[model samples]
Target chain A: MKAKIYVTLKPGVLDPQGKAVAHSLHDLGFDDVADVRQGKYLEVELTTPDKKKARADLEEMCKKLLANTVIEDYRIEIE
Target chain B: MKSAVIVYPGSNCDRDMQVALRKITGSEPLMVWHGDSDFDKVDLIAIPGGFAYGDYLRSGAIAARSPVMREVVRRANQGVFVLGVCNGFQIVAEAGLLPGALMRNRDLKFLCKDVHLRVENAKTAFTSHYAGGQVIRVPVAHFDGNYFASDDELKALEDNGQVVFRYCTGDGELTGEANVNGSMHSIAGIINKPGNVLGMMPHPERLIEDILGGRDGRALFKSLLKTFPLAA
Candidate 1:
């Protein structure tokens, strides 16, 4: 089984990298881009065959290391 | 006081930290490797600034989960004093020892220079030597030294007197221009709930002697071992 995780900075948190990218986009004439936020996309291969088990394991990974819950939120999709 | 410095694979400041500890306490600090989980107990443990694990996944994410950090967390829970500097600050925060996180600088640049810090709480084990409101110069070097916390956590940190130092002007006034890295409340250092742990973005170990251009950082280390005060 494989799980996909998207870890993104909390909405209210400051995103300097995202802001810089947005500025660059504006400089390149993409003024329509209102805002930009940065995040991480991770794919994990789990040995578990059970979808429930894969979700649980992926959740643990996010809580323990994949995402810093203090400032970032994570989403997990198992298949 | 017996002290130990945790040396991760990419920890470049371990030697400087060891030197600072030994210079202040007059006793050599143990150099504990990141892999080893066991070592002699010490009065203080320091996680020095450096690109641990090449700062992959996040500045301190990898090293914070290393074998030694697990033990460091256990020892910290046992009331052992822990001082985390720069990347160390990120590690301790990532390890769940401290609240909040250090993120990219507001300008999205790697900052490396001296900045003024005002002692906000002088009662901690790390800042006892500094009088409240006193300003000192310390160097900060990191890309992700900007501190971030949830609204509730920020309130708790402020209400609990956890904020130990704040970026300020030379005259000790807090202002927007003085905030080196967009840290919430311009916080430069903070003590944990137990007050036994401290995490700061400044490099106190780098300025322990006059020859280093300034000795303002000496007080931080001196506060840990009061027997020896940096000569006035």
Candidate 2:
């Protein structure tokens, strides 16, 4: 099984990189792009066939290492 | 003031800290490797600055979970004094030794320069040699030194007087421009609740000698020596 993880700076936390990219987009004439919040995409391979176990393990990974919960939020999707 | 400096892979400031610790504590500090967790306990543990693990996932993320940090967390819980600087600060925070997370600089740059820090809480074991409100010049060199904490957590840290240093003007005035990294409350350093651990972005070791630009950082080492004096 494989899991897809998305990690992002929590709302209200300043995302300077995102802001800089957004500024570039504005200069490029993407007026509709009001803002951008950048994040990380991770793909993990798991030996467990159990979807439930993969989800649980991913949650633990996110909490313990994948993300610093103080400023980031993570979402996991198993495939 | 027996002390040890944890040496993580890619840690460039380990020797600087070792020199500072040796000079002030009057004893050579053990350079314990990151994989070693069996080193004997000492009066103080110092974490130096550098791009640990090439900062692959996050700054200090991989290194924080290394074997030695496990020992660091264990020893810190028992009230052993710990000091972390720059990347060291990020490691300790990532390891949960201190509250708050250090994010990238607001300008998204690696800042390397001397900044003035106001001593917000001289009562901490790490700041005892400095007077309250004293502004000291210390160099900070990091990409992720902007401090962030939840509002409630920030309130608790402030209420408990854990904020030991704040970026401020040379004349001791707290201003937005003085906070080069955009840290919350202009915090340059903070102590954990038990007051046994301190994490700061500024490099006190880099400024410990006069030939190195200034000796503003020497007082901090002296402060630790005062806190844990050797038996007579």
Candidate 3:
């Protein structure tokens, strides 16, 4: 099974890197851009075929090591 | 006092901290590697600054999970004095030794300069040598030093007087320019709830010698030595 996790900064937390990217886009004539919040996308391949177990394991991985729960939220999808 | 300085793979400031403590206490500190499991009855444990684990995923994230930190945490909970500086601060926060997390600077830059800080509380073991509200200059060099905590956590820290230092202008007034990293409430350093652990982004060890610029940071070591009289 293949899994993907998206990690994003929590709401109300400042994302300087995302803001800088948004500013750079505006400076480069991309005026249509409203906002951008940078996030991390992780792709993992698991040997387990059980979707339920894979999801649970991925969430645990995200909480334990992949993401900082204080300011980050993560979602996992298995395929 | 017998002390130990934890040395991670990428730690570059362990020697500087060791030298400062040696000069003040007149004792060579143990340089403990990250793989060490025992602290060996040390009076103090210091986590020095550097890009530990190359700061690959996050600053200090990898180093916080190292074997030495497990023992450091264990000892710290038993009332051991643990000091974390710069990247060391990040490691402590990540390991839950201190409140709040250090994120990238507000300006998204690697700030490296001499910054002034006001001593908010001098009753702790780390700042007893300095008077409260006294402004001291310390050099800071880091890309991610902006401290963040929940509103309730901030209020609790303030209520308990855990805020030990805050960025301030030379005249001791808080201002945006004084806050190089845009830390919450302009916080520069803080102690844990129990007050035995302290984490700060500034490099006090780098400023302990007069040749480096100022010896203002010497007070921290002096104060710490006073806490453990036997170490002197």
Candidate 4:
């Protein structure tokens, strides 16, 4: 099984890097872009064949280490 | 005062902290490795600044879960005086020792310069040597020092008087222009509700000596010595 995780800063938290990227896009003539928020994407190869176990384990990882719940929210996709 | 400086991998400020502790308290502080589980008998524990664990998962994220931090969290809850500066502050917050999360600077830059800090709460053990509303010059060097907290949490921290320091102008005026990293409420440092744990972005150890441009940070260490005497 493989797990994919998306970690993003929570809404209302200032995303400076994203803002900078947005500015660069504008400089490149992408002026229609309103905003941009940067995030992390992780792909993990799990040995477990059980999707249920992988989902549960990924949730644990997200809460404990993969994300700082204080400022980030994470979503997990298992295949 | 008997102090212990936790040395994490890539910690650059542990030596500075040790030097400051030895000079201010006239006692050599114990150097505890990140893997060590025991803290022994110590009056103060300091987590110095650095890019711990290469700041992989997050700044101070992996280091906060290291073996030694488990003991740190336990001791901190038991009224032990714990101080975290710069990356250390990020570690403590990641470990849930303080409120709010330190995000990247508003301008996305690593700020390294002297900023004036106003003493907001001098009643705490860390700031008792300074008078309330006193402005001190200290240097801050970090990329992620923008403090952010929910509205209710911010209100609670304010109501409980946990905000110990706020960035301000030299004359002690809290203006938006004085906020270097865009920290919420211009907070440069804050203490826990019990006032035993303090986490701040500025490096007090860097400014403790007169030859180091300023001695504004010496009073902080002196204040701790007064509260936690070596004899005790």
Cα lDDT tens digits for candidate 3, B1-232: 8889999889999999999999987788999999987758988999999988998777888888888998999999999999999999999998889988999999999999999999999999999999999999999999999999999999999999999999999999999988999999999999998889999999989988889899999999999889887535
Root-mean-square deviation per candidate: 2.4, 0.8, 1.2, 0.9
In model 3, the runs with Cα more than 4 Å from the true position are none
**Candidate 4 ranges beyond 4 A from true positions:** none
Model 2: residues >4 Å from true position, as ranges?
none
DockQ of 2: 0.94
Interface RMSD against the true structure, candidate 2: 0.5
Q: Candidate 1 on B1-232: residue-level lDDT in tens?
A: 8889999988989998999998877789999999998999888899999999999989999999999999999999999999999999999999999999999988888999999999999988788889988999999999998999888998999999999989999999999889989998898999999899999999999999999889998889889987333331
Q: Candidate 2, which CAPRI tier?
A: high
In candidate 2, residue B79 scores what lDDT? 88
The collision pairs in model 3 are: B1-B231
Residue pairs clashing, model 2: none
Using DockQ as the yardstick, the better of models 1 and 2 is 2
TM-score of decoy 1:
0.96
lDDT of each: 0.91, 0.93, 0.92, 0.93
Q: What DockQ values do the models have?
A: 0.90, 0.94, 0.72, 0.84
| Candidate 2 residue B229 C-alpha distance from true site, Å | 1.5
Give the clashing residue pairs of candidate 1, or none.
none
